[model samples]
Target: MARCFDGNKLVIASHNKGKVREIGELLAPFGVETVSAGDLGLPEPIEDGLTFIANAEIKALAAAKAANLPALADDSGLEVDALDGDPGIYSARWAGPKKDFTVGMEKIHALIKDQDNMAANFTCALTLAWPDGHMESFEGKVFGTLTWPLRGDKGFGYDPMFIPNGHAVTFAEMEPADKHAMSHRADAFKQLIAACFGDNQ
Candidate 1:
């Protein structure tokens, strides 16, 4: 495993502030300097991939090539068993161009209101790409069920209604630190860090 970022500068391919902040917090301990796509003035890619891994790779590659530095990207969404994993990759668009997750959550809740299985989980795929074309991918998921009447004001996207397995509180109701400790993105990022920086502690 690659060990120690050693003050390496990397690009986080995302324009979302929430995502950028979460990623920055995850990478901070490594002494890595992070920059976002919005910081670099890079245009968001079409993200027309058929899978999360593909989309993550696309964004990572784009950022790596553009910034000539190592880059990381994540593609994540909620997958409902009752909905046939629908709004998987389309999670963002389900809220429309305005990125209003409230509407998306309402839509999802309505669609699954009558279903017996409200089981769902959040999935995250992370891709790291180098300017030389070297790349790696990792994935993680947090199994849980959905909830109605979205709770809490914290977290973004579908967090308000997501109740992880074995937990009674929604992600939106949890602190950022608490959420990061068990989130799908956190799981994937832990694998990424392990892959990039082995057990140095």
Candidate 2:
């Protein structure tokens, strides 16, 4: 059995405001108070891991130790099949030091414009780590195709151009409630909640 989250306070181990906001919204129902690492002035840990899960764990574990509290960290990115799953873990880096998605999106579009397959998917790996080094991890994926002329500005990152299966609109075009219903993060959260917070529900 996985270890449950027994504490009321949890640290969201991320510096990205958008990611912190989205995660905060998800935890709202449980009445779990969340404080971001950014807010706490916790230094961002180097994500040297090769896989999403590893990266998530690195962040979560670091925060847990630093804060002496349980922490949740999420690592996610886009993978394009035509590009050999490129920019998977480097999704954020592609935007350069400024973390600009527009530049990253444009680079991706340029590379695969002539390719036949625009197949892409968003993958999320969520890790919850306790101060004692105990941890639980889950992964989720939402497949979609890449589109040109980025459509919406509602969502952060590559959401403006990726349309999930069975959806005609891009992620950035959808409302938060709508996107939350079928996002890679949501999928991972389902498993995390089921395993770690089932009794709280």
| Highest TM-score against the true fold, candidate | 2
TM-score of each: 0.95, 0.99
Q: What are the clashing pairs of model 1?
A: none
RMSD of candidates 1 onward, in order: 1.6, 0.6
Residues 148-178 of candidate 1 have per-residue lDDT tens digits of 9889888989999999998999999999999
- Full-model lDDT for every candidate: 0.89, 0.96
Steric overlap count per candidate: 0, 0
**Candidate 2 local lDDT, 133-189, one digit each (tens):** 999999999999999999998899999989999999999999999999999999999
User: Which residue segments of model 2 deviate by more than 4 Å?
Assistant: none
lDDT of 1: 0.89
Model 1 reaches what TM-score against the true structure?
A: 0.95
